[model samples]
Target: MNKILIIGAQGMLGQELLKIFPQAVGWDREEIDITDEKQVKQKIIDFKPTIIINAAAYNAVDACEQAAEFELAKKINGCALGYLADVCLTLNATLVHYSTNYVFAGDKKDGYQESEPPNPVNKYGQSKLLGEREILRRSNLKYYLIRTSKLFGAKGKSTMAKENFFAKMLILSTKQIELRVVDDELSNFTYAPDLAQATNILWQESHASGIYHLVNANPRTWYEGARALFDILGKKVKLIPVAADEFSRPAKRPKYGTLLNTKFPKLRDYEEALEEYLKDRN
Candidate 1:
């Protein structure tokens, strides 16, 4: 059995990973601040884990646009990976890191492949891309970079500044009679549990050190996804489709950020995953 160390264990994905790998050691933000280089190095040295899964990330997309936040994002999302990778190098541990679909420009009609060139449109994507590069460039440790799309799961212990899209929509449904969602932005939706299962499979079966696209099958606009959720919950609301420009946001988003999984078996459909999540939440 591989000794596993899960960083950011309080977040949604991280929490799911803890459940999936119960014997693994878990470190939330309160336990170890990833940006603190000395702490990261010291923890890994003490744990001496055979596998280090970094589910921690600075994912505040809009807030990441500010100069101070940009630097913070770089530290947490970009520079910290180099530190982790360095420790992994010394310990001879395999590092598993999560990335986002925002790495791509989202201009490609057929969705992004692992081979596609990354041209990030926002600071968040740039930071994640930087992290990926740092892991590859700074260390010789075996690594797996898994890129996922829109994620939703039961809330965890982490103090996330923003809620997942599904939770946001559910909240909006109660407070407002009409909801407006961006129709221009299209991407695949990923359930955190499915992602956790896939991560385990990739680790045990593939064991190859490279980039892989892991997400729920099928792509849909935010509007379509929200509509499906409303239907499933038996909530009656008028959902209006609006362009991305109508709702102003701090950061630029990819118009089409869908990812294609050419490496692993496709997970369940987005509708099925959403249904399961709703049931679990209720």
Candidate 2:
């Protein structure tokens, strides 16, 4: 049996990974801090896993604008990855790291492909991009750099309590009669369970090790996603579509962060995944 170690095992995607790979060893932030090089080094040497999946990331987009926060983000998202990659290389373990679609400028109308060069528009994206570069530049180990977008899971009951966008919209629908959502930004919405399934398939079946765009098929705006949630739940609410500029935040989002999967089989549609998530929620 292959020994698998999952960092950030308590996070949204991390939780799903734990469920999927129940035998895999899990470490949350409390158990191991990736930012601390000493701690990370010690843990990896102790576990000596055949596969190391880094599910941890500092993903606060707007908060990353601050000088201090940006530095921390880089340390966690960028520099920490270098440490993991180096250790994996030494241990001869395959490293699996998650990235975001934010790496693109979103200028492409059709959506970004895995081969497209990354042009991050904000501090968060830049940090993630740095991590990707670190892995390729430093590590000789076989690695998978998976880029996804708009993740939602059933781990938490509410969006405020959980980090998922779909749960947040569902929570808002119950309280607010009307909601304003950004329509200008376009991206694929991914369901965590479906993503987990695809990831496992890639790990087991695919021999090629490189960047893969793993996300639900069909691009849609945030507004459209919210509308679909209401329609699926048989809830009627006034959803107003607004441009990305309408909401002012510290970080800039890609206008078209949708990702195209040219490597593996396309995952299920966003609607199909969302419906399954909502059904499970109920």
Candidate 3:
């Protein structure tokens, strides 16, 4: 008899989560603004959900570097979690939040473990770190902090939704004969559907709530991933591997943000997941 509440249910991951838990109540930005502490508390209190899953996030990495956007990111990605955690404690409900591997400085070339310290190098990462701290600060609060990297799946049907890497690459391939992709930064790509299904498994199995890294196996660069996609589609696009510095941006990304899964079983390879996604897209 667990009543579940899904915040930010309109996004890509959130959409998959809704499909996985059809019986669960969902609230997107239109329905609820997580930044509004009072409103969030009131809404959750009224609903009296046994579990609160926060699928919302300020994921615009470059945009978050701007002062105004940084403040907004802080409120949504950071401060909002404090209120959510507070409400979870009050109602004795479990809070499941998604975090990013960006929380780490990406200094570890091999990968990061669940027990490693977080040292974010960018504003967006800093903001997500803030949310993690907010939840962890409350020792008594029942929560699950899932840290994942580059996610790819069906695009969300929301105006606020941002396109995933695979989708962007596909569109670019159709438009251009050649594409210049970054060769540096290495991280695991996660499939939204697989991650969603794993979330349900974690909940049903009653896994001890802590930090978990759920992502597809095998770490690779963006350039490599793009090449794989073109090969899969049999598209004749010349993918030129270039340094990350070639593309100037407001935010600095991690060089190696691969999140290693030590707790749960490893997921499918990103290439396999990507192939499935492309087939679905077609």
TM-score of each: 0.97, 0.96, 0.98
- Model 1: ten consecutive residues of lowest lDDT: 155-164
lDDT of 3 at 111: 94
After best superposition, candidate 1 residue 8: deviation in angstroms?
Answer: 0.5
How big is the RMSD of model 2? 1.8
Best by TM-score: 3
Off by over 4 Å in 1: none
**1 or 3, greater by TM-score:** 3
Q: How accurate is candidate 2 locally (lDDT)?
A: 0.88
Q: Candidate 3's residue-wise lDDT over 88-185, tens digit each?
A: 99999999999999999988988999999999999999999999999999999888899998988888877888899988998888888789999999
lDDT of 2 by residue, 200-280 (tens): 888988558899999998889999999898898888889999998988888999998889999999998999999888888
Global CA lDDT of candidate 3, please? 0.93
Predictions in order: lDDT: 0.92, 0.88, 0.93
lDDT of 1 by residue, 1-282 (tens): 689999989888999999999999999888898898999899788989999999999988899999999999999999999999998899998899999999999898789988888999999999999999998785466999999989899887877735789999988888998998999999999999999999999998856798999999999999999999989988789999999999789999999999999988999998999999999988
Cα displacement (Å) at residue 213, model 2: 0.1
Model 3, backbone clash pairs (residues 3+ apart or across chains), number: 0
